[model samples]
Target: MRKEAQELYRAEKDKIVLRPFTAKYPKIAPEESYRIQLALIEMKKADGAKVVGKKIGLTSKAMQKMLNVDQPDYGHILDNMVLPDAAVFLAGELIQPKIEPEIAFILDRELTGPGVTPTQVLAATRFVLPALEIIDSRIEGWKIKLCDTIADNASSARVVLGNSPKRVEEFDLKLIGMVLEKNGDIVQTGAGGAVLGHPAVAVAWLANAVGQFGVSLGAGEIVMPGALCAATDVSAGDLLQASFDGLGTVSVRFA
Candidate 1:
């Protein structure tokens, strides 16, 4: 597992895609995958990376069903993974980069529990921001199973956060609407409810899920509940923007 972790770590650093571990380790369990992810994270930390937050993936029922998983997966978000809204970057720098719009929570209070509720998640949240998650896979051609993705840090790459921040009580997140546009054309539209019925519910699940590992969703850390829609492919010279009903817009440019 440690050797596999090293391979994944090197893949990210070298921007190289690798064959899915499942091809060789077909019987790999989800638990083993998470352990590999943790080991990979430790490798990043040892090299001076700082964990700034956490990201939850596969929150939608459709995604879970497609992945043959019953629950969402998580990955640590490092400080370097964050980018400002309207940022531009080279497309060739990433391996199979894609984008997903999400609601990000900046917690005001620490949340730790084996049974955290959505209400508690809201209480602990300081504000929610419009976000764009740039997801990439270290696995070749993005062929991955549940265990494959779990071990690849949930395929997290970069995050772009919007300027607007609103408290949970300000609006009903479950009904919040979002429209994704690429090159000035609408590509996808979705509602927050697509994410585990409500985004906060997913956050609550994350808090409890990680609690079993003795990890707490810390105060002031950004927590991305999940994507509102399917991720869209990214390419050079492309401009993408996501507009939420009340959260304003966040965008990125691929150079």
Candidate 2:
């Protein structure tokens, strides 16, 4: 990445709570994009931020096709991105915000290596919960190239997890049904298969990808597989709820 582009990227990310840049910077090559991402991570670390987990994006075939990418990409979610139940925020607080239903995994053991398997991910997971991922795009109108999105932490904003949790063995997560509701009305529905054929497979892919960067999925961290369905736009006063068949539900109302 050009030093100029790296500096611009960091400046844009640092404004997460203010006026986030909505326009894409100068086009950056893939290697430069990765460099920009590394710079952002280092900047966050300099600010004493701790990476709590990872989020895999574009895992579904539909998303891949929509983004015109052949493979999945992920981003690091810091400890600050996590919000507890009943958390409130303004709809205008984020730029180009969207919400998606997801299944989140809380791991009981560290997972590393390129050889990690889906079965191992399943075995390592301690619990699963219904989750809503608040996705915010730093790029204008959610317009961005794959490299731009990856460099912006995969558009991650905030994550809300449900109160109820289920053990990995208690549910066929690969087949769990999800219904996304806005204003108490169903807007979209999907199953776990929409996520890379199986949610565990997405987790395995994330573990392998992190390994390539000399990192590993640590114990007690939350890992969110890709969304179970397409993202739904949110507006002020919108009451959003994501109901999972057995894992229970999570909801948030925009102010």
Candidate 3:
């Protein structure tokens, strides 16, 4: 697992793609895959990367259908992965990148669970904000399975967050609408209900999912509840924006 983690870490640093781990180890269980992810995360931390929070992936019907996966995957969010809104990014920084919109939860209290609830999540959350998640697969050709993606940090790459922050009481997250635009054209639209019925439910699911690994959602951490729609391909010179009703908008540019 350490060797596999090393290869993945090197692949990210060198900007190279490799065969999916599942192709090599067909019997790898999801539990073992998460161990590999944790190993890779430890390597990054050794190199000065700080774990900022966590993220849930494949929680939306669109993403699940696109990935052919039925369950959600969890991944750690490194401090470096967080980016400012409206920032310009170099296209070459990642391999086979795609973008998706999410509702981000900024936590004020630690959450641990086997039985975490959405209400508990809201209680611990300090702010709810609009966010864009940039997903990049290290697996060659973006071929991945549940275990493969789990081992690859749920295909996580960069995260761009809007400046607008709202309290949980200020809005109905489950009914909020989101519109995604690429190159000045609307490409996708979805509601918060698309994410496991509600964004907080996704966060609650994450809290319980990672609890088996003895990991807890920490205070002051920014947790992204999963994309509200399917991922969109990105390339050089592409400009993307996502606007959420009542939550303001966030945009990014690829250079």
Off by over 4 Å in 2: 2-31
Q: For model 3, where is the 10-residue window of minimal lDDT?
A: 206-215
**Between candidates 1 and 3, the TM-score winner:** 3
Model 1 regions lying over 4 Å from their true place = 65-70
lDDT of 1 by residue, 1-255 (tens): 899899999998899988988998989999999999999999999999999999999998756765567778999999989999999978887989989999999999999979999999999999999999999999998888888899999999999999999988999999999999999999989999999999999999999999998999999999999999888899999999999988999999999
Candidate 3, RMSD to the unseen true structure: 0.8
Model 1: which residue pairs collide?
none
Prediction-by-prediction clash tally: 0, 1, 0
Give the winner by lDDT: 2 or 3: 3
How far out, in Å, is residue 93 in model 2? Answer: 2.0
lDDT of 1: 0.92
Report the candidate with higher TM-score, 1 versus 2: 1
lDDT of each: 0.92, 0.81, 0.94
Number of the top-ranking candidate, with lDDT as the measure: 3
